[model samples]
Target chain A: MTSGPADAGEAMGSAARAPTGGMPPSRDRGAPTEKGTATPPPGTGQAAVGAPVITDVAGLQTVIDTLAGQGYTVIGPTRRGSAIVLAEIGGTQDLPQGCGDSQDAGTYRVTDRRDEAFFGFAATPQSWKAFLFPSRELLWSGAAAPGRLTVTPDPAPGKPMAFLGVRSCDLHAIYIQDRVLLGRAYTDPRYAARRADAFIIAVGCSDPSSTCFCVSMGTGPAPSAGFDLSLTELLRDGRHRFVARAGSERGAAVLACLTAPTAGPDDLSAAQAVTDTAAAHMGRHLDTRGIRDLLYASADHPRWDDAASRCLSCTNCTLVCPTCFCASLETVPDLTGEHLTRQRVWDSCFTSGHSHLSAGSVHGTTRSRYRQWLTHKLASWVDQFGTSGCVGCGRCITWCPAAIDITQEAAALRVPAPHDPAPGGEPA
Target chain B: MRKLAVWKFASCDGCQLTLLNCEDDLLPLTDQVEIAYFPQATRAVAAGPYDLSLVDGSITTPADAERIRQVRAVSRRLVSIGACATAGGIQALRNFSDIGDFSSAVYARPEYIDTLATSTPVAAHVPVDFELNGCPIDKDQLLTVITAFLRDSKPDIPSHSVCVECKQRGTVCVMVADGIPCMGPVTHAGCGAICPSYGRGCYSCFGPQDTLNTRSLAGRFAFLGMPEPAVARTFRTFYAAAPPFATESSMHSGGGR
Candidate 1:
């Protein structure tokens, strides 16, 4: 069951790079627009500034190989059982080709797109959090003797990682996480180390799922920044090509190794057209205008009761959210009482113990727990990180067993509650 | 060192086995606490008063009822583990039927059998400090409870539904995706959403979560085309006698159906 790095390398060599006809006629064309560059939105992260280049499917393999050769584990989306999951990959074959996902509130299914186009799918269940803030990590281990205790931090991963096919919303999620884990007053050393050492190759989302609201969130359909390289997949005129843009010095170096032609205006327009189509086809929307204030003000809104009725109080929404970061510690001692190891594992606000105090949990009821989660994600997070916690990835909607939509809930808060004819009186 | 003991009554030894299943934590745990009286693991029984007592199974007989009281008196903190000790286990399904008729049919000599008419949780017989809800409690959670006891602090066992674990594990919901009926919304989290990850709905191996909305979840089951009888059957699975689940199941059972 274990796939070695060499197997991935061999698969890359064989599956990718098959020469196909219908390469677009090359013509002299200037850079299409500012959108084509690796420059990110202002104040997001380090700007990735590089020229956009057009490359065929085979050229993309070169990018993967370059990173793999540099001793970085290349992690990408792959078909595992019935769903696409993030896993280590060696070649383009590991990518979920000719596949797309159908997502709705409380539903997700993998379907064939009827073409060999990679990056056709929407969000996978697995997010980049798996790479950055792992579910379980050993913090440190301690050995104790009479009147003495020695402790050592856990060893960091030997090889850094290169994440491939990351979407725009996910990039924003990573940014939000950076603010939470590393940007503020406190920084998680392990997360900082992993983030600093890793490379990110983002893919512009061209096929947004019904559960997607990234366009409304203004995070993407097309990534503006926070990547070493950004790619827009173009499949037209019986040809499959990718318009790759480098976002960093390292990205430019990697692109330089790939044999790609200078993208013509037609190729650039075609790529832009794909993103435009994706933007127009965004399946969901969220009205963020004054959302924070509205949520904060409506503490007594009856919608909390309505949502809680259907909400299982399952922490799935927080767990699948790319930016939600909460952890608890676990201590394990060896049989001799001489050795003890402390570990950190993911925790969720919906859990009873998450808000446990001297007396009991603060938010004990399901209604209160759900309210706390939604308000924090939409409102409180803005105050904490100077940005909304939700990147509008819509994982909360798709993974929710009860099909409770955050957009609907937020919208519900805006409508004024029906006034009771008399306080504590029965409806007239 | 803190002294810990494990006791079992009338049910499967699955919950006790979960403690042994913690191969990595068990040895390390022993370093901090002495395994005072775990008959399943060793014959070397250490006498109480014990620092902590983890009781498994349900009170099914008069003798078992008396034993729990003695256990509660001896242990400083008595915690119930698994669905049986917390909510009477799957055997509580007999609460809906005639126990006398059931005993006569199963036993060669019904007269010789001395059993309570109802299978009841240990909490019904004695004041329990805490309860770990699961058919066979999760090993990781059991470790948490044990360690918390050693430290004289509260264990951080989540009372949220299985949906949270499913989300954290990035497992798609089987109920929503394939129209499968799941108890994930009302069942306590601890199994790590194992069934749902495998593309099946939760069977509620963990008992009812805190403030469970069983009516709403049952309504969803009906909307998904599950019959009333099947909906009732689902709740009556592992923790049939649990208050919330019992009440919800009876609501759909159509009065003695």
Candidate 2:
């Protein structure tokens, strides 16, 4: 958490400038290595971060414990209710062991993975957004002082977080957030602080849900770039192993501490097949070809009304979405108006407050609200953020009360609207 | 100092008690505003021409109808608080049935009981400046409205569905996750999604949210294998007098408790 200025600047550079998931290795160097905290490698410049290593279940725990020993609070997915939710972890036992989930539109089932595979699950209900861009944050606070009022920005939290068992789609989502929060002209200092102190242990998807469309989104099935260390779980021939690759210099240092060997040829191919199977078995598809133009042009389509008829105007899709970063500030004053706090809470386009003005809410109808969300995610976001907002993790599809699939809606909008003839003229 | 009055027409007094339940803020709030006409709490009944009047309960009698008009005349601002004041509440279920039958069943002497044919919201009788909806209004929300009125500004009360608050609370959708028939999709927020957090379905305690798809949620309830009458009863709970829930509840007839 308390890295030197060089390491902090380099860590910020990796995620800030990295294009999409193309996160380059941000080498941490000469940071006064305390308690085995990624012992600064030989050269300051990039060098061999070691080859991919194969580790057993116990080695996985060693990696986790080592990260913790380095003053990083490790967070991982664990079984909570019928869902796998992210929470703080002490060791491997906190992970959702021998558990897998089956998810469809408006339906979910947590089934047994049958084997003792630790990372056998899909994207959790709670994304990494909660850890980074929290639901509610106190940006600043004001108190009445003698003669004048003083306001101070809330300092970012001090915990250095290490996330274990992160997926490829989620990694891409983090990259997207990095672009939104850090790469901008005016950086959110709080988000920058959290993102800089974060380490990701990306896990390849062995069990994807029916709602998953990361293949079409060009983000997932396997971890490619955005992580420090990428792990692929192998459960074959009564062998339980993880083919782990260090993506950053810190990852190599962590791997050196573990009881793992250099990955053999057999281990590499077995890991490839695991991702290949997951890729082929993807249940949904989204055709992203000219999607921005299609949604922008189809604003007046009757399909919006049809969708609104079945829609509940609930904010689930926006809240569950990893990339949907819309927030509103609420001013809270004390009884005598001497003390006040301004909180930034997650806001959705679906809410009437999102479109509020001096007169009233601009988008009063459910159709308009739904349109704003859909168009922003697919079309308008391209103009503002230079990329489509959706990473296609499919939390919206899985969590929607009405089961309104974004992919299906996008496909429905792709169909050309028929032209209407003049009132008294012959039908065209 | 501004004067504040708490009025009751035909409520459980739970909404009035919510003001008293503001234990921490109550003493501080009293310093700023005079508790003028709170007959329930204080014996010292200060006269009206009140700065603010919080009207609770529905207008169920002709005398209450006359009294609300008088309360509206004296108060600078009238805020109808709770479901009874905003919607006719659970008592408004009698609006669907004959009052003659209800009168004979409840009262020993039917002729002595002089009541209106239907229970109606306070807004139905007088022009209410604001309506705070909930079975018993949330303490924080009530305080917000009071503070907003004191500041002469609009209160930050959102009219979005309970599902929004439920999802924000990180509670898994009971309908989507557990196949429970919940009214969160159509009911107004402000309850902090209490029902779903405890694994129980919302009973529409805060009435309908703005632009809610009642028909869609009702259909979802039906798809979850809930009986047609059970679907109707779900919409007919705390705020049945609200037009949206009332209209949706009326679609399914017969078999009821």
- Among all candidates shown, the one with the greatest DockQ: 2
lDDT for B206 in candidate 1 is 91
* All-Cα superposition RMSD per candidate: 9.0, 7.4
Candidate 1 error regions (>4 Å): A1-48, A420-428, B1-6, B17-52, B107-112, B138-153, B167-170, B176-178, B254-257
- lDDT accuracy of residue B136 in candidate 1: 87
- Highest TM-score among the candidates is held by which one? 2
> Candidate 1, clashing residue pairs?
A48-A247, A315-B164, A316-B164, A333-B28, A334-B28
Candidate 1 structure, TM-score to reference? 0.87
iRMSD values, candidates in order: 2.9, 1.2
What is the C-alpha lDDT profile of model 1 across A1-428, one tens digit per residue? 11111221111121212111111111112222222212123133444455688998889899999999988899999988777889999899899999999999888889999998899999987689988888777878999898998888787656888999989888888876766665543456677667777788889898999989987677888887767888999888889899988777788889899867778899889888988999999888888776767777778878889998897766778788998888767667644557888777677887777787768888888899999998888877666556677877888898787788998998887777778332212311
lDDT of 2 at B99: 93
Q: State the fnat of candidate 2 relative to the true structure.
A: 0.55
Deviation in Å, model 2, residue B54 alpha carbon = 0.9
